[model samples]
Target: MEYGCYVCNKIIKTGEKFTFTKEGPVHMDCFVAAERKKVPEGKAEYLRNLSMILDYELTMLVSLLSLKSEDKETSELIRRRINAIEKQAGETTGLIYNL
Candidate 1:
């Protein structure tokens, strides 16, 4: 079955990851950003922006880490920034690892 993310109203296809929030289906990225608490509740635009930024950061971090395995300090810094996101959530990935 397909569900739409309440924050972005985008279809979350079957087998794709999503969260079941009080508001309804939400993408993993959207749920992560919303849980971060930097944005006020009910503000879809801000949530969307934060969600995209989180996705971008995760992508960049992955690419950078793959190319430069020796940069522990910088990698740790990025990991900290991500961990500061502040909570554990129910996700579909086998890796319970958070950003």
Candidate 2:
């Protein structure tokens, strides 16, 4: 199948460096320039705040996974309480392979 760059309006040739956005595929340089144009006057304050919350929550999830995998850390003690819901396989019947 054939494809084209979303930003450059040019054919996206084989073996070329490219990336994807929700809009479609684009050359990496075009995608970077397009993204740079979108910031420093970006989304509305409400949307930005929601994005910040999402970023923080994703960090929390990584920390939780580290704990679950028994990685040692000194700084993550504040969130140690999430262990309350941590359960082993079959700790509750039929709860196989909990994340």
Candidate 3:
């Protein structure tokens, strides 16, 4: 069975070093990156802060899509970028729901 990295949402290849959280297995680098991130003052604060970031990312993605790039590779890359951002936004929403 293939496991996914929590941060990148990419497959964690066999034999890779990872750490387990209450959520699931995450690559060591991903875990460290999360650890180094600044903690919010409170749940409401965290949600508000993340919401702003998510909003900006979504706005950027929408703007890019409006340009209607003809390059297949560029379009595919944008789709992947949007997917990754949406996934992270969902995870953040889940955290708020849990609290």
The digit string of per-residue lDDT tens for model 3 on 1-99 reads 789987889888754544445787676556544643644446556655555564565455456545557899988987888677656645644453344
Q: What is the C-alpha lDDT profile of model 1 across 16-92, one tens digit per residue?
A: 54556567878777666556554445655554554565455445444443443358987787566545432222222
Give candidate 3's TM-score: 0.45
What TM-score does candidate 1 get on C-alpha atoms? 0.37
- Local error of candidate 2 at residue 36 (angstroms): 0.9
Residue-level lDDT of model 2, residues 14-86, one tens digit each, is 5454544557766655754565455455444433443344334434444555554344564455355434322
RMSD of each: 10.0, 14.9, 11.1
Candidates by lDDT, descending order = 3, 1, 2
lDDT of all predictions: 0.54, 0.47, 0.60
- Local distance difference test, candidate 3: 0.60
Record all residue pairs in model 3 with backbone atoms less than 3 Å apart, i.e. clashing: none
